[model samples]
Target: MPQRLELAPPAFNRRKILIHTAAAGALAAGVGVPRWARAQSGPMRIVVGYPPGGGTDRAARLVADRLQQLLKRTVIVENRVGAGGRLAAQQLVNTPPDQTVLLLANPAVMSVSPLIYKDLKYDVQKDYVPVAAVTDYDFGVAVGSALPVKEVQHMLAWIRANPTKANAGVPGTGSLPHFFSLMLSYMAQVNIEVVGYRGSAPLITDLIGGQIPLAFDTLDSLLPQHEGGKLRILATSGLKRSPFSPTVPTFKEQGLPLSAVGWNTFFAPSTTPRATVELLSKAVFQIMSEPETRAKFTAAKMVPVAMTQAQTEASFKAFNTQWTPVIRRSGFKPES
Candidate 1:
């Protein structure tokens, strides 16, 4: 009887058992694999803070459309409009760590709003991570047919001469246009009233109708009218001349010593895995780098930009450092 063959059951080591159990639990929660890998089953969403047909919305749609083709998955743009993009940002912050949702944010929501809104729901630095910057745009000093000016210097002189009519309409208060207008007036030693409108549409209407002598808005907002002869863009706020309107000199070129540029950037919740962010960043860079995409953005008056994740983060931090104190000193408060 081979008694030795009937060996006792193998010893059960507690440590080995526990280790195996923990690893099994981790894998059950989908922890070992990246969240984005598991997220591929669901449709990806790009949240736009603004309404449809707006610049931010358009940029989101462009990225969404191409990303769908590249990934062979469904992509949609969700316009979570309100509070000048604050609501959408807050919503994003509250969302659990997910790779399927992203936000298309503007400079106002990222740089200026946080500085001004004391009760803002989300902290731009802590709540979100920059994925990529899709488009870069400049502000334009546009004048209606009423103002007889062809250049920024001439426009400043006219504002100085006509003190009663020294007013500049802005798309919104606490916007780049509003701050830039104030900076322009201060640098040029003029007293131009900064008027805030509901949005670019109304401000542009006033400009075209000659109700407002001059307006400060995005180049894309004013470029069509500027080209249509409904208004004249005296100067653009860029370090260099815009390719869309190359003849138009920049504020720096015109000796104003000032320039401000804005961008539409994609951001994800801070908890999102780095691998997920890299995946989306690579897709955006590829789409924006394409010649056809560049042409489309150019036609829409937005300059296509293909910045890496690190570059996008650097640009965002730089803007916050550069503009926060300036905004504080300006004493311009948003109308809550």
Candidate 2:
């Protein structure tokens, strides 16, 4: 896995502030700044924290396609997969700020990585700037259809009854899946063991193979299997029933309203220009609003959402505060 992006303080705006003190002063600067300087000149690489074949990767590809068209430049997605997505986050923050690289930015790196690693090389708040982000479906908790369990209560009963055989698989130890599964254990009042995999792909594989009978992961990963009759969804981790599966129950329906939607977002290096971020964000939202894009994401059990850079940043801030107490109590601490 790539390391998390190291945080560098935002460049002081004093210079730009002074230069744009008045409309005439701003006009002088605006006229002098070349169109080429304002426009992105090269290919834009959309980096993902995980490898291809999963939700983040697939969504990145979707956004990449639209970005390429909208920007009139090549848009590429590269998977940096590792260290709970810290690798990709770190890579983006370290890249030059020429609007050349962006991240498919997973919570594993942005929200959770800061809570887990002792020395997370990057500071999500300071080192990376949101470009655009999607609030995809929440992680779903399910069991093999072969299991007798049907709901959260039943699953808890089954786990408690067959303590030896009951276990759940998550994407990675400190990733969002792991955090949610851990929360499930707390809610269920049982010590269901959590097993981590390289990514959602292998985790789903083991799930179907029955190497693991229970698991909690992104709906993007479990949708195909669940819909195909490979696994039975016990409870979706999201607060509401996903539009993709009206029949599937949510943790909230079962009376656990604490669960909320998860997200996969994109961000640029901290040094990247604000204008570039706005352009990228606009392109992403435009793509997400398209029926084809929404349909495709719905099919994958991942919802298509697009938020402006400021909106994305605000959302992340709220999520950070929302989960802080819960995570801190779990004995996890942010990197110093």
Candidate 3:
């Protein structure tokens, strides 16, 4: 055959080919950019009010890691610590509802602070919508050697007999542990003078050295000392015994009919689109349900909970209702 003449192939339009492929992808992936991917165009952040290494911060970091993988976006944990978490809460209030920032807050910031702080800058209900509940933890009723009380009943009797010496220390003034200790006093019909410490370390030091006769703090904070036999945890403020301290009795189990369960929940600015909130909420639920997450929470003495938006809100509301009367009855004055 004389030279076989073959028509030259049409020149490839790289841009046009890319455009077609992308359009085909869009159609295959369902009409437009996925809602999640669109919302995640920018980096996401989880804001924690407490310093790093604390329970809330740790939980936020864990979630950030998993969310970065699931959403294929950068995620970071920001510690906006000040004013016992109020500063962070206020920051969230002013933050745009772009779904880039979310607050990992405890009951102190979410439910108690608003009730106790007269000059609170943000109304939680109006400023933020609960996205997910990450963990549930309870307070520990610990007694020092100076008090010499082994049980809640014995502690109550001691408080009654030594009313002038009945001082209970808490990690912070307006913290749930403070109010929880007061609730114990109110229920037992004994007077207890509540004192606030800077954080758990000093509170724990005082508890061990008899600087304070009794103290209440998170079960996680008190467990080490209690387990070391430096102090004793008379009771825990949960409906059931803590998994970490199965030997310890609950306040209700000890006939107090009182419980103080605290949770670390995530909240986004109220103006965030419902679709964004739902997407983030689903991701959180998935992360919390993972066995690795549960193991980490358990190791930290916190019960892992993966509550949806409505359930988280309801839990927060019920917590407010449960503690409002006790806080009011304790006569805790608001800080300016």
lDDT value, residue 155 of candidate 2? 76
**Which 10-residue span in candidate 2 carries the lowest summed lDDT?**
1-10
- Winning model by TM-score: 3
- Estimate every model's Cα lDDT from 0 to 1: 0.77, 0.68, 0.77
Scanning candidate 1 in windows of ten residues, the lowest lDDT window is 1-10
True-structure RMSD for candidate 2: 9.6
**Model 2: how far residue 76 lies from native, Å:** 3.2
The deviation in Å at residue 254 for candidate 1 is 1.3
Q: Rank the candidates by TM-score, best first.
A: 3, 1, 2
Model 1 lDDT per residue over 41-89, tens place: 6788899999999888988888888888766678989999998899999
Task: State how far residue 212 of model 2 sits from its true place (Å).
Answer: 5.5
Regions of model 2 farther than 4 Å from truth: 1-39, 145-147, 157-166, 188-190, 197-213, 228-230, 299-301, 332-336
Q: lDDT (0-100) at residue 218 of candidate 1? A: 84
Model 3: residues with Cα > 4 Å off, grouped in runs:
1-33, 36-39, 334-336
The TM-score values for the models, in the order shown, are: 0.83, 0.76, 0.85
